[model samples]
Target chain A: MKIQLALDRLTIEQAVAVTRPVSPYIDWIEVGTSLIKEFGMDSVRALRNAYPDHVIVADMKTFDNAVYEFEMCFSAGADIATVMGAAPLVTIEACMNTAAKAGKKVMIDLLHTSEEQLEALQMYSDAIFCLHVSKDQQEMQGSTQGTEGFYVPPSLSGEGRKLAFAGGITVDMAQALTRIYPHVMIIGSAITKAKDPAAAAKTFYQLKKE
Target chain B: MKIQLALDRLTIEQAVAVTRPVSPYIDWIEVGTSLIKEFGMDSVRALRNAYPDHVIVADMKTFDNAVYEFEMCFSAGADIATVMGAAPLVTIEACMNTAAKAGKKVMIDLLHTSEEQLEALQMYSDAIFCLHVSKDQQEMQGSTQGTEGFYVPPSLSGEGRKLAFAGGITVDMAQALTRIYPHVMIIGSAITKAKDPAAAAKTFYQLKKE
Candidate 1:
């Protein structure tokens, strides 16, 4: 399991500062949707320049104009970009084609997507499927209330597709989830909002290795 | 009907330059999703500062963290922000509450949303329910292919909900849609991608009046 640090709701400077100390410990550095919306693709470019070796994920949560968005982010230095699972299959296919041509990767975000919707995406074997809980749902209800008991659908897991899990992930939760062995474990506030982000990241790093 | 000029897939400089000439002919200046992704909320601020009298919309297409994204855009000088209609009911409610508190407005982008989804949104009478066609769908197929004959569901129209229409709007299409008397008519590439954007906008402006 690899740890993906999600930098959300932070200014560009704060994101860079927080990641500097923990860059050596994390596998992927995610430029969260809010941060991207706050600072633009420059945030991705800045993070890419700062951590040349680390993979950068732009959490665009793109639902439309997949080709343009994927190309724009990838050219700006994103190694991986995300598309919403709820989007039409054609949109997802466009994103996949863009990623393939650019030699980049796409992570399909499965936030609020139905099981039936998940079945249609099984053919895109090269893409990484992510199980995500929306931040608004978490804020409206409680941390443990949204997407807490999500299971990877049999068709996807059985097909050996790359899988990722996100939302309110804690150190204990990460440890527990490691047994199931997702390709990427995305953690946000648990690290970025921590008193010591670097230490929190280090702990998750250790958990991933275990 | 109000003509909202959508500034999409442009650099901040390009967006500003294009709108400067056509600002007088349009009712609202929209900072499109691509612009927001490429330049952030600062793009909203820049446009707001540049066109103080005009209503500036930040097409955040917010699907989650409604309060945060809405507040960020609104505080930065957006007169209106967008939320995806495909989002959960709780999420939409949260966005409406945020907009109400900020004394701004929310436009619900109904791209990829179903008629069943449209039913749940009728309560947001003040929110503009937009009929959107995804750009990827437009490019993958032909211009006349996607969202070719979209109609406002009677459930929403009967409720006196404010309605808007988008997606590959031409001057002829705009003229046709005007007969329906939509509250807002969103035109994107028809103007922005035109050889002479200001001239294209002027033509649409005349059509809107007719």
Candidate 2:
């Protein structure tokens, strides 16, 4: 599993400073929803400029006007951008098409998506499906234990599936998560909010290899 | 019924200029999701600064981390902010609480939300419930005609239930919609994209008073 570092609730400068040390340990960088809301596309451009080789994911959490959003995101240098699975299928399709045309990727966020909704998304096999826990739910539950409750739809998992898992992931959870081996393990507060983000990232990186 | 002008896909300057004349006729100014995505909270701050007395809405379309999103939006000088009804009940509840604390308002966006989900939201009666047709859906249908198929959940509508309707509202539709009389009728491109925005707003304003 590739480790993706999610930077949120931080200014562009702070995000860059935090990620500089952790960059070597993490595989992908996420310009999180908070950062995007606080700083706009400049946040994505800032990370892309700083880490030339790193894959940048703009957590747009887009629910409508997918084509416009995905177009703007990819144009702003996002290698991958996310749209909510809760969005209409046409919107998801728009994101997929926009990504494909731009040679970028779209991560479909499955936050609060029903099983029936999940069934309709199977045809978008090229896209990455994210099993996400809301940040509020994580805070309420204390840790990233919400990932344990993730139900992988049988139709979505068997073969050639690109799945990502995100919340407040920690080094301890990394060990167990490695077994299931999602395509990407998105770590946010556990690393970004850490007193020692580089060390936290290193620990998760080392655990991913184990 | 109040008229809301949705400023989208425009720079902060363009948004201000477009809304300046239309402001007299509109009750609320929505710093639309597109403007927010492109310009961040600065867009809300800009509109609020420009029109001190106007009700400025930050269309945050928050789906996760409601407290953080709503707090940021409200702090940025928005009189109202939107959270997706498609969001988990806990997240929506968090938004309601946050908005309550701020003495602001929350508009729950019912985009791609199921009837069963709508049933769960009746308790948040204090919040303004928006019956939104996605921008993508409206575009696909060639106009704002998607609002015609809107199904207002009986449980959600009645006396004292504040409901808003959005998505490409036109002058012709305004005549038809006035009978059902949603609390706020949001017009976007219909005014902002018009060659004569001032005239469009005046026309709608006249229609509303009729």
Candidate 3:
């Protein structure tokens, strides 16, 4: 299991500063949607410059104009750009085509996507399907309630598609997912908000290895 | 009817320069999603500083973490911010609450939203329900094919809720929407991409007035 550090609600400077120490342990550095909204693609460019070897994921949560958004992010140095699973299939296809042409990857965020939507998205075998639990849902229902376990859709089982899971991920949760083996395990506040983000990341890193 | 000039696919400098001449005729100055992704909330601040009298909208297209996203945009000087209608009810409520507290407004972009979702959102009467056609849909089906007419959900009528329509809006399209009288008519490439953008904006402005 690979650890993806989600840098959210931070300024560009803070994002760079926090990730500097943890870069080596983490597989992917995610420029979260809020940070991207706060600082733009420059944040992605800045992170890319700071950590040249790390895969930079621009968590754009893109819903429309996929071609333009994907091209912009990939040009700015994003290794993987995300499109909302709730977006139309054509939009998703546009993003996939752009990513394919650019020699990059797309992570489809299944935040509010319906089961039918998920079924339709299974066609994009090359794309990474993210099983995301929305932050608001966590806040409303209490984080401990919903995100503790991995949910592999019945249709996705043994389909050979890359999968990632996100939302309120903790050290214990990370250890649990290791057994099921998602391609990426995205953790946000648990790492970014820790007293020592680097040490916290190192712990998750070692846990993933174990 | 009001004309909202959408600024997308431009650098911050270009967005400012293009709107300088057309600002007088536009009611709302929208910092589009692509511009927001490319330039961040600073784009909203820049337009706010440049056009103090105009209502500056940060089209954040917020999908989750509504409170944080809405607060960030409102603080950055956005008079209005958008929440995706496809977002969860709790998320939409969070955005509406934050907008209400800040004395700002929320425009719910009903892009890819289902009728059931629309029915649930009708409770937020003060929020502007934008009947938006996804940009990719326009490209796939031709601009004139999908957005030529306005759509208001039967449940939304007579509810005293504000209505807005967006996607491929031309001067002629704007004139047609004005007859039905949506609270806002959002125009993007029609004005921003025109050879003489200011002249194009003036035509829409005059059409709204007539």
True contacts kept of each: 0.68, 0.63, 0.73
The top-ranked prediction according to DockQ is 3
lDDT of model 2 at residue B109?
Answer: 92
Write the residue-wise lDDT of candidate 3 on A8-120 in tens digits.
Answer: 88889999998888888899999999988998989999999999999999999999999999999999999999999998788999999999999999999988888888888
Count of clashes, each model: 0, 0, 0
- lDDT ranking, high to low: 3, 2, 1
lDDT of 1 by residue, B28-139 (tens): 9999999899888879998999999999989999888888899999999999999988887788999999999989999999887766777888878889988877787677
Residue range A18-131, candidate 2, lDDT tens digits? 998899899999999998887789999999999999999999999998888888888899999999999888798889988999999989999889889999988888999998
CAPRI verdict (incorrect, acceptable, medium, high) for model 1: medium
lDDT of 2 by residue, B1-210 (tens): 888899888899999999888889898999998888877899999999999999998999998888899989888999999999999888898899999999999999998888898999988878899988789987765545343545678988688899888877888777778877789998999898889989999999998777
Cα error, candidate 1, residue B77 (Å)? 1.0
Which has the higher DockQ value, candidate number 2 or candidate number 3?
A: 3
Please compute DockQ, using alpha carbons, for every candidate against the native two-chain complex. 0.76, 0.74, 0.78
Per-prediction TM-score: 0.95, 0.97, 0.96
Candidate 2's C-alpha runs over 4 A off are A141-143, A146-150, B142-150
Model 2 scores what on Cα lDDT? 0.87
Lowest-sum lDDT 10-residue window in model 3 chain A: A141-150
Error of 1 at B171 (Å): 1.3
Residue-level error in angstroms, candidate 1, position A185? 0.5
